[model samples]
Target: MNEALHVVCPHCDAVNRIPSARQGAGPKCGQCHRALFAGEPLELTTANFRRHLERNDIPFLVDFWAPWCGPCKMMAPQFRQAAGDLEPTVRLAKVNTEAEPGLGQQFGIRSIPTLALFRGGREVARQAGAMGAADIVRWTRGQV
Candidate 1:
């Protein structure tokens, strides 16, 4: 028997039920018909954060960052690379702390470029500071 996984659509914010075995087969969203995994970090805001968190059966690696922070800007490419290396096992996303201050405050993100891993709708691991793509992949693999 194959278990179905709930994957949130990156393009339309729709929920898709995908079989675990076929995850690597490139599943499409039932609602918008878009690919489930986009090989890059999804831009998350207050409107879609909860839905993505609560809906996705896979773990989410979220970069809590701000626009003006140099470290965050530097780490963006690394995070984007990590997304390609990490999925379709894990979901990568970014949250702009400047635009979504409430989410940052709620997560107690005192620093920019914080990496938080969420599983089952709750944060399981967190890290602060900039890291390379290899480091991010290693750290996330260890945590999840």
Candidate 2:
């Protein structure tokens, strides 16, 4: 089913292989020997986002935000804190709409802070507006 994944280490950014069967048991990087799943929000660029979404079997909560938006800026630190708390269980990521206009347009992102939960490259749920860390955690509870 092409379920195998190559997860990028957040610590050293090294790539590691994760068998699909072991997704919930936890996975680790071969090079740095750290958990391959950082369990927090990882930065995704235009170049790597697609690959990451395609490969990782874990559920993803992605923030589609912009640098210029006031709410987006305000939500950034809360999102980061939430990421740190959720790490390794629910994969968190951020997509900067201003930096990736093509992706934003593709996702039909009309707001500054839109979030989507993805599994196997398909989105199952989405939300918009700035959110507190507690709300973020609650919203993502069943998503993963």
Candidate 3:
């Protein structure tokens, strides 16, 4: 039997149980009927952050950024590209420190464009700086 994986919906924050073998077959959220992996990074706020972090069976990579930071703005596209390359296996998300300062403070994000990888609800790797899409994919894959 294929193992079931818990995936949190990027659209509705619904928890969907997906078969491991069917994850790459275009799964949709049970509650919202939206594609679970849309090849885009989810914008995370405090309200849905913990659910995505703890409930997802796959590893989660969060880009902690702010709008005013030039590096963060530059890396935004790369991060989005990384999302397209990494999704369905690894979940990619972003937290704007300017909007969610508490999350930044809670995670000890001292730098913008920090990439933090979490597995089993715990941070397993952290990288601080702007990186290309390939580098992001490589680093995330290496960590998980």
lDDT of each: 0.96, 0.80, 0.96
lDDT of 3 by residue, 1-144 (tens): 899999999999999999999999999999999999999999999999999999999999999999999999999999999999999999999999999999999999998889999999999999999999999999999988
Q: Over all chains combined, what TM-score does candidate 2 have?
A: 0.81
lDDT (10s digit) by residue, model 2, range 93-135: 8998888898899889998799898888899899999999989
Q: What is the C-alpha RMSD of each candidate to the true structure, in Å?
A: 0.5, 3.5, 0.6
Q: What global local distance difference test value does model 1 have? A: 0.96
Per-model clash counts, in order, read: 0, 3, 0
The order of the candidates by lDDT, greatest first, is 1, 3, 2
Scored against the true structure, residue 63 in model 2 reaches a CA lDDT of 97
> What value does the lDDT take at residue 107 in candidate 1?
96
Candidate 2 global CA lDDT score: 0.80
lDDT for 48 (candidate 1): 96
